[model samples]
Target: MAEITDTALQGTSKSPNTITLQEFNNRIKRLLADPSVMNCWVVAETTDVRINQHCYLQLLEKNPKTGATVAKIKAIIWGNQFRFLNARFKQVTGRDIGNDMKIMVCLSVNYSPQYGLTVVINDINPEFTLGDMERQRQEILNRLTQEGIIGQNKTVPVPPVLQRIAIVSAAGAAGYGDFMKQLTDNKYGVCFYPCLFQATMQGVKTVPTVLAALDKVEQNQHLFDCVVIIRGGGGTEELNSFDNYDLARRVATFPLPVIVGIGHERDITVLDYVAGIRVKTPTAAAEHIILQAANALAHIGDLSNQVVSIARDYIARAKEQLSYYAGNLPIMAQRIIDTNTLRLQNFIQNIPLHVQRRIEGENAQLARQKDAIKNAVAQVKMKETMRLEALGDKIELLSPRKVMARGYTLTTCEGKIMTDAAQLEAGKLVTIHFRDGKVVAGTQSVIKDK
Candidate 1:
């Protein structure tokens, strides 16, 4: 294309100050191609972005105060330049350029009669977009803090074991799949019941869809122990939706504790600040739940072991007490019998002396009186001996061992002697003791007399 000068337009025109459309376009191109204008830096908001072999965009400027579109221009990045710029942009900002994103680009001015003026973008400054995004993020955070709702979800109590979960993520998303896999395939063999609420996790629909999903989760909140929001890895552009104030507010004030794992390690969104817990990745979220359940299981196991230990110790002590009582009962009974027998023998010996003295004194009275006295003494001795024999027999029959031997048995329930049928329940376990051994039995039914 040839550059047309104002002097040349003057020379070629049969009509003064008039040029063909092609000539006019050429002039505009020539003027824009000035060395000073080449590779000039421009800042604009991107709209209607399209990527093919070459990336095309509509760069627009909006009034800062009124937010009304003021100036608009077409732009392009050649395939080679686009590849490098896009990669570098994503690297620096953790996001790819997309619609409605503010961006700065170095570009060269170009013009064509057919396609009109378009800027050829040579390079992009990712920091510009990053600064814009950070500014918006900070605004939302400040608003939440002012409302005092930033810590609302954090105050929600999480259960000791998170067995039931409400998951918010795009269905079949890599992050969702990873979370489920990590949660269900845990080494602890813990069980989890997760109900997924599908939503678009990126782009313009991200905020509304996520809010709807959270609403659904709230509807069935009782069914879930906590709510988990997760997304797979994506460019920072995709994460911008999570920085939305509406989504953040909803998550912040949610009734159930909210756990967010929506970004990479360094990718923190507004949701991260308001959520009850935040983790780096979806897998990390799953690991957290699994860890809680595993810990609870471990605690239960410890408690069970302690209970068993206590019960065993109690049984050991009971057995020792029973053994001591069983061994001493016979000895105690025999000692009582021996003491009584000695008293009877002493009485019998004194009776003989008293009888001899009575007989000597009565000898002068009469032989008949003496005979009667001797017979009475003999009868008294025989009677006393018979009474001692009877007393010993009564003692032997009243002994526990003797009673058990004579068709009697002892029964206990829950380690206590069961003296009444009222204490027995239908399915109660009881121990029945005989003189020789013990039997354990369960009650089929209990009958108590009125």
Candidate 2:
């Protein structure tokens, strides 16, 4: 050892050791803070991510071939940058990057011996994130299908009429407003009792926040008839949150019917597939409800009209029957009267004819007997003429008509003949019967034997 100078004592340093590890790190930090050596470059794949409460993110990248982490660094996104990054990422990927997603980042390299790490993030490439989103969507879809929960939500019964609805959406979102207005202004007078289960509609925390809202609705199943998940218009990337398999499973197994109104006609999510009903927009969902209500009302109206018509027909038939009976009543009564009058006339005519015939026959028989008696009396008078000459003379004396013929007129009162002088009275009107005629006479005198 030659007598080394004080400089040689530090192993013959070519330059003086003027900087410490802390000093070098501070200098490098200052240089990186400048907008020159710290440039931006896009890299693939995100790894080893940490989030701080200050809204700064620390991330790293690794090499897939070697299974080794070559790019180990500490990258920071400030609170403001973090917000922008989160929003942009969600806009591009429809999801926020945490530990789960892979992202393409624009970053700067930083090297320092004391800090012993490098930083490499400044921005993100949206196109690359979108591509990643498609792959993730397919993966989740496959998982749900394999897990047999793809058709789970479809099994829940949708109410025949969608009256009470539970909505999970960002409050004040244009989508929510549209849905409410459409339902309220429906022409069918459809009523909706909307119970809002508010949640984040987009971002890294969107899935969990939405799931929590769904959980509340599920726990209180009686409060709602159906669950509706709706969102405002957005890019395809922003819709990726709905493709999650876990969220799909939850929706599939929900007790009540689920409806999704998430995107336009071109966009279809896993949630849409799992939901019992999927509509292109929130307004369309409202229209579906109105249509169901209209159909029900129309059916009821038809039934009511049918019932009324049937009642009217029955009344008309009854009136016709009553009129028929009333019209026939007079004719039936007249027929009865005519029949009874004909029978009484026939009976009276027959009775009179029969009585007249019977009286005429009896009179004829009496006449014949009288004639025979008269003939017998004449023969007897001829045979006894000689012997009865004296009797004949006596009979002639007793005969009143013979006495009247002999100029002795017979006087009778009330059909009795007056044959004695005692029957005469003074001032009495009497009938005198001769053999040929009767005379009215007044008695002049009367005498009575003592």
Quick one: best TM-score, which candidate? Answer: 1
Model 2 pairs whose backbones collide: 94-237, 94-238, 106-122, 107-120, 107-121, 107-122, 153-252
- RMSD to the true structure for each prediction, in A, is 29.0, 31.6
What's the lDDT for all of these models?
0.91, 0.78
For model 2, residues 304-419, the per-residue Cα lDDT tens digits are 99999999999999999999989998998999899999999998989979899989999999999999999999998888886688788889889877766778776787677776
Please give each candidate's TM-score.
Answer: 0.66, 0.52
Error of 2 at 157 (Å): 2.0
lDDT of 2: 0.78
- lDDT top scorer: 1
The total number of steric clashes, by the backbone 3 Å criterion, in model 2 comes to: 7
> Model 1 over residues 74-94: C-alpha lDDT tens digits?
889999989999999988888
